[model samples]
Target: MVTWLGAPSVAALREALHEVAPQLGGGAIVPRNLVPDAAPEWSAATAVLAGRYVVKFAWAEPAALRIRHQVRVLGALKVSAPWLALPAVVVASESPALLVTELAAAVPFFDVRHLVGAGGRARVAQDLGAVLARLHDPDVLAAVSAAAGPLAAPVMPAATDALRRGPAAPAPDARWERVAAWCDWTDRVLGPAPGRSGLVHGDFHGGNHLWDERSLRLELVVDWETAGPAEPEYDLRCLPGDCGMELFGAVVDAYERVSGAALDRDRIMGWHVRTVLDDVLWRVEAGVPMPDRRTAGEWVDDLGARLAGFGVGG
Candidate 1:
């Protein structure tokens, strides 16, 4: 659902069409591969049929639960956020573990280059802030949770433990120690959940949204498989890094303005650190090439410095 690369083999495509085509209703549903070149190994192949419908199958058997949950999330969002353009489900199945949806023609927000310019960046930031505000509205969050049920809880401390104990990286580094320290900081600072929570798009980075560059509007918020109830700022961590501090501030200001809630910089920073730690541990365990190790270390170091400046960390 985020994005994908690579192509399915002839035999694989045939099997998928045979299994999925029938359930999608009557039409000439010719399948076209949609994965981009240079996709990550874990990326799944997506097929667009008849240029109007999209068929996304899980790359592995383990993804079935998330795919099914995405169907429910989209269904709920359709009713809850009518103005937002989202893919409507045509058919969903467990055996092939595929979800068919109406095709949406738009560029992923991450791919849009307009944000490099000052004026365009500010506009996009404000627009995105407003959209996030709408999605995180208390009533909307309640409705989405009621429809989709509780989502998986944050895998923070467990991920920290894994990083410390996992065989691939058994030797704990200073960065790992910082991660553990931050986890403790988070616990102390956000003790017993201060009652400010809402729907969180667990993997809500820019890559998960589609944007219309021309209109400067959000076309869709895709990849709802990770969505669930959590702290309101959980989704803020998704903002792309290309945006300068000025633009980032504009986004937070707009978000607070639209949502009528003050943004918590400390909590947001904590969540961001937790996510980075979790990702590093997952990659180490999975044997995937770790991404920008030095950059990640620098980021955490800077985060610790920031927290220390604010008297949240020693």
Candidate 2:
């Protein structure tokens, strides 16, 4: 498993660039930090090289395998979905833990400071729906699996362990009890369904999506480090409340229209709730402060309200 210690200093990065220059198709490479200064230890600090390529060095040998997996997935996509704008794999190395790819001319949809009008929002929803449709397609999944080997094990166990390691004890507050109950509910309801699995971009929220401001389209999808096989709902979970329920509905409607299948509302809702709880657990374990010091009851209430709006309920 990868453990973060600290980012390499400018000098260290410079030495790394010097070493890898030959593999990069050689130029006077300039390194720019892809990670923000405030990011936590779990995230890797990537570098943009020569203004055209992005390079990420893993923290450990195990992490290097993860990068290799992503590279294979990208290579497979290059053949299966040529229309999708994804980074082209430039170089991958197991030793010294490196993966490099060409940079796409796009920005995460969340980073767009300018307001998008209703038309723009609809377009974004439709684009996402269609791409997600492709990702979940049976044909695409088979092709990617054949090319990249099977997706790795699910990440939930590690997440659960992290949550349990938090310092908070049950006696101090009823919040732990509430959290326990939520976990119990999730276990009973959210187990994966056989034959329902598909290719999932493990983190498919707006923050990971890159929008082409000039073309007004989703030109590229970035951060495939966690791509795998999972229920289709894993990708849709974060999208259900984006913009507003209306836009969420637009995404769902478009997805149904494109895929010729009804959205699995129950499963999606269950995964969304579990995802929210997992996020809270991760934050707590990381020693990061929670918003309003969120309690279990409050989280449940919020979940209830959000689901009700989508015509789903306990």
Candidate 3:
């Protein structure tokens, strides 16, 4: 579920949905044209409706299994959040590899960048971190997973193979070699810190988060295509890796303040490396130009340096 709906012939997907939902019969479903206010970087859909609920359906290959798993996880989180703005997944169908979630009235975290200089950034940071920390709590972990059902054993080497063989842009032979070596190193180091792993949101980049600029309120974290159990640090790395430490320092500090748990220096750097490699692999596999890799690499290197500065090494 890490990769997203490319120019997937939505025709196949739409056909699948129409068959399963069947409510689209005869005439038009008005929400068919209803796109969300903000678009997620990694998904193809905008909105759908079954009954009165508004849903956003994200498509993915090999998503049949992951979507099944996510419906349960989000269902539990729906209960866990209680009063907060959280999405309750309504349907997941393998025919189109879709997960339908209740749509919320928030903007993408990136879309609200205009408010970053305002007081809202800090509060958003606090809320984001607190949410992750709260979800990371051991009790929360057991409850979420027990409700989600059994987790698939994460296969680092297979994933590494997918990386080398999948969508990231092709580097010079030299860079590819370096990336391959780093993958091996990551498997050895980062893979082990997956202790007490629960449902990890594999992708938590700003593009996936929704927030209210005026109130600094976090809305639905829309993309669960990558949601499931893994390492806690892996999820922690999600924020720092994508948003840059300057933006995420507030989040980390806020989470630490409330959780009273220190971030593991070892796992932080290790997972940071994993995130960097993942971006690289994604660009390469997608057959995008290599220059895009250089640009993304600069950002990731900056992120790596920041992670190391967080006292994370190895």
Q: Compute each candidate's TM-score over C-alphas.
A: 0.73, 0.77, 0.69
Candidate with best TM-score? 2
RMSD (Cα, Å) of model 2:
5.0
TM-score of 3: 0.69
lDDT of 3 by residue, 22-57 (tens): 553232223453333323433345444434444434
- How many clashes (backbone atoms < 3 Å, residues ≥3 apart in a chain or on different chains) does model 3 have? 14
Write the residue-wise lDDT of candidate 1 on 1-314 in tens digits: 32211144434544565666654444444545434342343334566666687776654433456676677778888888776656667776655556777787777876774454766766777777888787778888778777767666433424434534433644234555656567777655555564576776677776677888777677887777677777777777545243434566678888988888897866665566566556656555655554445444565565566556546654
Q: Write the per-residue lDDT of candidate 2 for residues 281-314, one digit (tens) a residue.
A: 5555566555548564465466656766865534
Backbone clash count for every predicted candidate, in the order shown: 0, 0, 14
Model 2 lDDT vs. the true structure? Answer: 0.65
Which pairs of residues collide in candidate 1?
none
Give candidate 3's root-mean-square deviation (CA, Å). Answer: 6.5
Q: Which stretches of candidate 1 lie over 4 Å from their true place?
A: 1-13, 23-45, 48-53, 59-62, 88-90, 94-96, 146-184, 192-194, 240-245, 290-314
The local distance difference test score of model 3 is 0.58
Poorest lDDT segment (10 consecutive residues) of candidate 2: 163-172
